[model samples]
Target: MEIERSDRPPSRVNWLLRRVMRYFAAPRLNMREDYEKVRRVQRQLAVLPGPRFHALDVEIISADGDHPIPVRVFHPREQRRDEVLLFYHGGGWVTGDIESYTPACATMADLTGCVVASVDYRLAPEHPYPAGLEDCLRVARLLLADPTRAGIEATGEIVLVGDSAGGNLAAVVSQQLRDEGVAGAKRQILLYPVTHWDHDPATSEFASVRNHGDDYRLTNTEVQDYFDLYVPDAAQRKLPTVAPLMATDLTHQPDTLLITAELDLLCDEGEAYGAALERAGNRVRVHRVNGALHGFITLPRFSRSLREAYDVINEFLDERVPGKDAEDAT
Candidate 1:
């Protein structure tokens, strides 16, 4: 499948921004304090607040029956759909939280006309690997069991949505639900998901890692650093739970709308996962945003790439039956 490309040249603003980020925001995996700095930076980046809306924060028990997990529910001004979007924010499993992702969640609810529930799962270097994954799974199961638990009045479908590392969680949770023979999300939207374990250009199978790894907003060094914190055991990184692309069986998963940014290091692997899903006899649609970087979904509402992504996402949500055959849109 051929990915769509923009005829327009890369934005000068983006180029300049990347240069600035390359120097100032470069990952320093030395101390635990460095992670806090990353989180602070993420919070500061969310300057564009969303339109006023009703929001509530709720605490739900974790899957382990031990701790409580925080979830934020956002209600759009006008409701157009009965579905609830279970969102997981991306911060490489370390930085992002409900507060940092509030603007994006609010905008998502308003744009899609679906109540958005953002999961504030446990982060890494403190709660590594399966801890965060467990929190996410517990929330997904609770919502699927009863939508009203999260104040979702509408008893419609529960769609799993996530970007970057959170996208990885959504995919894994969907698969785990299916494996457990429980009700799973009928639809999932993965935005530039981390589907593979390796990001090193020399070792990675995807060309995007080699082509765009160093120059974009998300660098290979930073991603590796995140992985180091999230999963210190390198051998375990290949597990299906960590890297969905490494899964031996991709069958019977949720209907998927996998979107990737053309310049993202994860682009090819995300698209490859979509292809694997299609080959495994699942319904899938893959769209690539040209000239965009990873994490574009959280950009300001006025961002062109952000607008283009939501358009595709909305179209996917509006489909009554997305069809059985996989589609690669240009």
Candidate 2:
């Protein structure tokens, strides 16, 4: 059941409309079929025109040397400092690669004027939990140690960004960094991140509302199923490292920008995490985009709220670390 939307101006023209069209036009598939469909859509996205910026393809050796992780680095046309963004793309931890998030990464790099490194981490049901987290941390350590490789300062601040499962990774990595006292990532950007494994009915209601009419895309059942595949053991829920919102301490981490799709099942959890951050006295800005659904960030064609999302994010980056362009204009 999708959410009943008010007949007003949609805050943005993103996937909500397209998915709604699909919901009516296509037949609802079973979990296996849905999984295949997701893959096909992702494959289509892998070839789209990504955001254009100064870019380089590179690889970082795993800290443990088990394998080398590939990363795509996007720099502002004008080099500025050691400041860089470490972005992880969301694909429910099962799919998605550097190509899947190309557009958003490109846009973020160009808009923020910071070198953006999109990490292609290990996926789950094959690699499992900490495998992805480990890859992200290893690459982060490597980047912070030498941001200058991409013309960024070695000691410059690093910002972590992710959407959906990628958002979960961003939170996990930042928390780990805080524990180790790794500096530079004073901020994190979460776009409709899934912060939990629990799927109670009330929250399911929210998911239904988020996709009330458009059932072709993400559904509440699908969310639960994905959790099953990624986490598997319910016992893992007790580990805050695994389920970030379940973590006891929220203090000492960098400030956060949490974006939620008002119609997304993950919406409530995202807000809850932001609230927790606020309660801990950390700076937090939460934006719930009305008429939007999960994964809207990737659908630039239907994203009426994309610019708004970009502004909210850039504003946060601006206040924390002023862009070089601002300085030049002064």
Candidate 3:
């Protein structure tokens, strides 16, 4: 199958920004020193002043009975939906925290008019694979069990939303919840998620890895570095938890709204995962944001790609049928 393409190209501003990123930001990470550097840089880039929203910080005990996970809850100025969004921030499973993502989460709560709970899961290298994943799962279960615990007056479905590695966690958590025979997330929204384990052009099948991996903000080498840090064991990398696309069973997943960035290395695999879900008879809508890069959601609200993404997200939350405007938009 052909990967979807957009008729429109990147805007002049986006083009210039991509050039700058490629020059300065798109380098393979050094697991030792770069972790802190990346965290600092992400804060600089993502922690901008955003629209005001009520926020609260709370702690949820981990299922392992070991420690408490920090969760930040954001309430929009006007609550328009009863559903709450359980969000997982993306940092290749390593470098992001709730504090670094506050601005983005606040914007999402305001834009979607839904209460947003941002989970601060453990990172890799120090915590590794199951550690972060477990923290996310524990938080999700607690919220699903009782939204009021997080200060949400939710009466509707609890939607799982995440970007990049967080998207990976959400997909796995949804499946695990189904396996447990519990009424878990009924809907999910994934933004440029990391679905597959491999990005090597020599071995991987996705053409996007070969085409856009090196030029955009997220590079194949950088992704490989993240995996090495997150899952040290290569054999475990193929597991369904680590790579959702590798799962043989895709049945009974939540209704999915999958958004991929046109210029991202993970684009094709994300779309492919959506196709697999559709084949398994799940409600799936795949939207490719034209001329957008991975992590575009954290860009300033005025960004064209960011605006288009929110439009798609709000439409999905509202259950509005997609209209034809862009190539393979929905």
Residue 44, candidate 3: how far off, in angstroms? 4.7
Q: lDDT value for candidate 1?
A: 0.87
- Candidate 1's TM-score reads 0.91
Candidate 2 lDDT score at position 320? 46
Model 3: what TM-score? Answer: 0.90
The C-alpha TM-scores of every prediction are 0.91, 0.81, 0.90
Query: RMSD in Å for candidate 3, one decimal?
Result: 5.1
Q: Residue-wise lDDT of candidate 1 within 1-330, one digit each (tens)?
A: 545444466445466776775664344343345888778877887654446778999899876678989899999889998889999999899889998999889889888888999999999989999889999999999999997777677678899999999999999999899889997888999999999999999999989899777776787888888899999999999999999998989898988999998878899999999999999988788988887888898877799888888888898898876443343231
Worst 10 residues of 1 by lDDT: 321-330
TM-score of 2: 0.81
Give lDDT per model, in order. 0.87, 0.72, 0.86
Off by over 4 Å in 2: 1-37, 49-53, 77-82, 149-155, 200-216, 321-330
**TM-score: which is higher, 2 or 3?**
3
Taking the tens digit of each residue's C-alpha lDDT, what string does model 2 give over 176-250?
877887753677899888787665555443453354324435555665666666677878854777778887888
Count of residue pairs whose backbone atoms collide, per candidate: 0, 13, 0
Q: Is candidate 1 or candidate 2 better by TM-score?
A: 1
The candidates, ranked best first by lDDT, are: 1, 3, 2
